[model samples]
Target: MHDRPAPTPTPRSALPVQARLIVAVGIASALHVGKLPPALPLLAQELGLTLVQGGFLLSMIQFAGMTLGALLGQLADRLGPRRVMMVGLVLLAAGSALGAVAPGAAALLGTRGLEGVGFLMTVLPAPALLRRTVTEPGPLNRALGWWGAYMPIGAATGLLVTPLAYATIGWRLTWAVLAVLAALCAAGVRVYVAPDGPRARDAQAWAALRHGLHTTLSAPGPWLVASAFLMYSGQWLAVVGFLPTLYTEAGWSPARVGWASALVAGVNLTGNIAAGRLLARGVAPRSLLWTGYGAMALGAVGTFTAGAGLAYASALVFSAVGGLIPGTLFALAVRLAPGPQTVSTTVGWVQQWSSLGQFVGPPLVAALAARVGGWQWTWTVNVACCAVGALLAAALHARLAQQVRAPRPGQEGA
Candidate 1:
């Protein structure tokens, strides 16, 4: 039987600085995402937010992604990834600066939703930009894996640091500082990354983009991948977003909760980096996906039901292993795309579902918690999501394997 050739290990030095910078910018963009979890408590107290409203604040960033990820992605392809990313950074900075002065929960929610737009614009074009710049398959795969790590790394950084900033300065000032950092990152992107080139002509670009969108939307592969991401993203965000609150309610100190939750989120990098190396070594994406989902299920059960030490440990394992799903899915997004032109569109589709999961997850979980009077029953949601994700992964694996074993055009007889 014919098989796809395994990707060779790419040395770190062989990866381009430009590609690394793009990942850095992604991490920086994610800092905004991570900033909120730690601050949710203070915001709740100062603004008199209910648990449901907190969930709204947690999910507001997904607003743009849920609504217009594909549209903006097509725009990036037509205009330029770098250009869209720059605009996203500006919006993020503006949103943050505005959020600093938001007088009430409603106003803060509005700012957060706007920031979601910026977040969507910043990340949706990343994979395509990386594809354009990092031409080699091995490096590209590894780079995409690191791209998956951007959230956890940035989120963990925010979880760890935001508490200190809030304690010393204040949430508003901390938010303003992050805004400044985002602006600086935008400048860095301009200096470090090359432009995606002259903008496409309106008619021609629109036609191409429309075609790419059609190709992306019509394919079963994109749909399956996006669905699987939806399953994974919702629970992951729900758990991570509420960890500070969970621990706080358990009577842990603010510093302790901040650092501990950061650790859980940070360890996710392990699986993400490993998924890249495993894929390079030719591990089946299906296996990695199932393993990630399985771990998440078991870990969530333990995290909610077990003793404190065990629960914390389980949370760490849940995050670390759960990392495999996003990294593997990202690698699959590249391979499963209908054509080179549709890579961003495919990623945008993936992000759209991912954002939907994020947008819906926290609020749903919060509502559940509100109804049940605690977080203990939240494991049911995680288990359900993981099961759905596993089924999707199985289907995706079979489809990918079939594609690999199918004959090339000139080699039908071989």
Candidate 2:
């Protein structure tokens, strides 16, 4: 018998539509994370949560990512990105539905942990999926850029919608609505996206997974990327996560706070898109990283120390510039993966560190605020994180340069 022909690649025309569907799924998963900030004040009233507890609540959804991101990545590589993501969406729906009925803080926290796992499952495989789907270099960069923006887009949408929903239907119903959205998104993914390739035998699967994990862990690229994300994500989440609470404390109305915070989060997508364009135009990733971190530090200072008008302006600037980091990191994760088979694994490792930063940053900032009795010292934490990020960027630059200088297998001494 003749050997079977290779499967045809996704047609260029269909690529954009499928990519959009994948991004839509990601945005839906992120809604669970973003929905909480707007509802936090109400939760405090009903749940009797303290500031520190609220901080934990904000970070709780990352608990699974902090622990299981890499393992799930390997699982994605072994099973299929599409399958993994669909399962994730179902779990997200379940978690949100459960959270809607949670009677107290502890029960809500448990549901948040479930949501975390779903979020990780949905998002961790996405960059790799995009890589497989969008073949052209320029469009691939742009798609990854949009993928990078999914969180901000979803979170901003959540911020804008949640307060209105809370006013009309209340937070519980808002959660239920998002759960439905997740289910819908999963159905879209199933219908639109391509299925995974055939699975390898068990022995081959185990061997490939082992190799992917080792390759991802041993490489400096993933570690550098993960470390930079750690520095960026912690401060970014801490500041943005508390914005609703901060505004409420300052006596702003819920509607006003929702709009303002949404604007801050929305501008982040602009930077994310810009980073992809810049990279495609040959801009250095390290340069973008440094600019993002520096701007974040300056914005943090203004946000904390300046008067009201400048403080709000600083927040917008902070979020917009800081957006460059994730877009660049996503591109780097794909470019720097040790092998084609290891892309999701590498992203998983990077995500775990990013989750850890988010997990720790909020509580640390909240503790500081409680100790100092004000938000003035908030700039200190952000600035320190940015400073560390700048140093990591320099190291990453050196690594990239080394890669450029190294010879390909057959090109040695040519």
Candidate 3:
């Protein structure tokens, strides 16, 4: 007797039409958020922020983004990414305004947190929404590639923009200007994003939360990927957070650090696209993860050394590695669950740890940097973290390989 057939999984290529729309949103928001970090160190000086306080201030947007990102992401499935993103843009604008006019650190922190909330609303649903939009495999791979590109663009460009703003007006004005850009992002969302109505109106928040929790905790691959995100994200964010400060301490101009940080971030764009091309060709996810983490390790070492030329070379290396991790990691996160029932839930769970890493890393690094009284130890810490990340990636790859189907024998064409 013939055996019963297994349920065929949705081909990665057969994603829906909405993916392009979501990718556009990703690019816009990524650029907006990317412009932020570069301005952070500048904001620190202008606002007279202490190291710890600055880290908090820096983390403020991220924390809100993390916390609200998950919440809104769940809502995105119910309320629609278009609507939620619109609301987030409003919040982003409001928060940016608050920070722009901030007279003290307290006010700045408050506003940054608000911006985080806005960012959360706008960016969280991107993966899910995109997944729903595209249909063809080539487009699906390209769309994911775009989604992956957003991070480094957001992170690196934010830093690169700082000095130009600082030299001309100041950090406060920089905030104000970006606030306007955030508002424009809202408009972009409304214009470009189509309302899909509600997805699963019956799905309650708690139900979704429960779903995400169960799927994530139950799956070793998801948890391992989360751990990878935590280690790499924390290390990279903390390292980048300290870059400008490190430069000044190293007796280089703040301008040099800003430029170098930009290079580090820019390198990530290439890494992400490279990962996408590799992923499309049926490369193992773990290979991408390892290469990304390895790049970070090299960059971390580069960040630690003295001398301008060495710093640039190492930073470029670091950024290259950093770029590759997110696309591969996130792609893995989307598939970490066993079935479609848990996709969003598992993705949200992975995000939870991503946020956790982002939330904690900067402050911990700042505290350590304060104790060490320089950025050397900060860079050292990052190198170690990246090394750990590489190891973790290896372990996850091994485990996931067991669960995921290998490329079929004689299978041709991705």
Candidate 4:
């Protein structure tokens, strides 16, 4: 009686604040990836970067993800996502700072590889962290939707702001400023997010990590989701990454190109948000994916083959509609994880393929452009990706239906 009941904690009340903070951290991390395109022209001039090298630069930041994503995911599982994420943010700051001082293209390229490692570490664990914090399905879906938008938002901001920053402070200072932003983001995560509890002893922890890796890799759900992401990411990055170049070549002013490219990228957020809301309202994931892919196909054709104004409009449609793929895939990754312990590993696996797509996509498109002497043929790549994605979406639908009909032991008869 004297003790009275301990004050009840309301996680629901705190959910929005925590979720927003987590998303903010993701956005800050994404700024590093987005900062490149706007600065590419300046970097090329200053560092003597060739066209192919520029494409490599665009894709180089994905190197770590392509090679180490799953392993890092396992590390995240062993270390706790919050700890991994904070460490990643610190790494990003360090990398950006170093990159700011690079003397040549080769040096800058090396720093970009370092940034790639940090990028994988920072983003791979985010979906799992969100799942752990937001337990309710509806809110979780919406939160994931926003999580998916972080890249486009950060990228769009970078596109719009970098030219202005370059005019005033130059690219080197801009890099330094981003480095500072990443550090602040890390600090914010430490103060606002709850700490991960104690760890298991070494042997048991290692065994558990091994088990999670095995389970995640062996699961069909992870593989299918990963494949779908591979199909979507390559094409998306290729289109968006080159838009600034495309506009520049068209004789638009730097400011005009920045603003226009930013708007195209920014519109993608709408589709991401819409996907989450639709999922929350009981819409079929397959339907949304199909619609997204179809629109992407149509948009790609229009973007490349049509006149300038129509092409810009088509780019908007391509990005906005294609946004549905990532939103749905994130939600699916959580739901389709073999178990709670495997969520990050599953996400890591998915991210690896996504990075592969990004790593290959830009270079492939660039080569194609060089070969054809224009971007008109770019639609073929996007269309092929869309076709493969549609087939994968169908397979995913079947897999989900099978899962529903044969629920896991704990979920049976519920």
Model 4 pairs whose backbones collide: none
Runs in model 4 lying further than 4 Å from the true structure: 1-15, 409-414
Each model's lDDT: 0.88, 0.88, 0.68, 0.87
Per-candidate TM vs. native? 0.94, 0.95, 0.84, 0.96
Model 2, residue 119: C-alpha shift (Å): 0.4
RMSD, one per candidate, in order: 4.8, 2.8, 6.1, 3.0
**What TM-score should be assigned to candidate 4?**
0.96
Compose the digit string of candidate 1's lDDT tens values, residues 1-414: 434223233465576777788888888888898999988888878988888888988989998889897778878877888899999999999999999999998889889988998888888888987877776767778888999899999999999999999999999999999899889988988887776667778899889888878878988888999999999898999999999999999999999999999999899988998998899878989999999999999999999999999999999989999999999999888788776667777888899999999999999999998999888899999999999999999999888877679843433442
Q: Write the per-residue lDDT of candidate 4 for residues 1-414, one digit (tens) a residue.
A: 123222223464344666788888887887887788888888878887777788899999899999988889988888888899999988889889999999999899999998888888989888877877776778889989999998889888888888899889999999999999988988987877777656779998899988989999988999999999999888888888889988898999998998998898888888898999899889999998999999999999999899998988999999999899999999999888888778889999999999999999999999999999998897899999999999999999999999899875554532
Pairing residues by index, what is the TM-score of model 3? Answer: 0.84
Poorest stretch of ten by lDDT in candidate 1: 1-10
Over 137-253, each residue of candidate 3 has an lDDT whose tens digit, in order, gives 555566677677777776677778767777789767877787787788778667655555534536575676556555446767767877788777777677766676666666877
Worst 10 residues of 4 by lDDT: 1-10
Q: Which is superior by TM-score, 2 or 3?
A: 2
Models ranked on TM-score:
4, 2, 1, 3
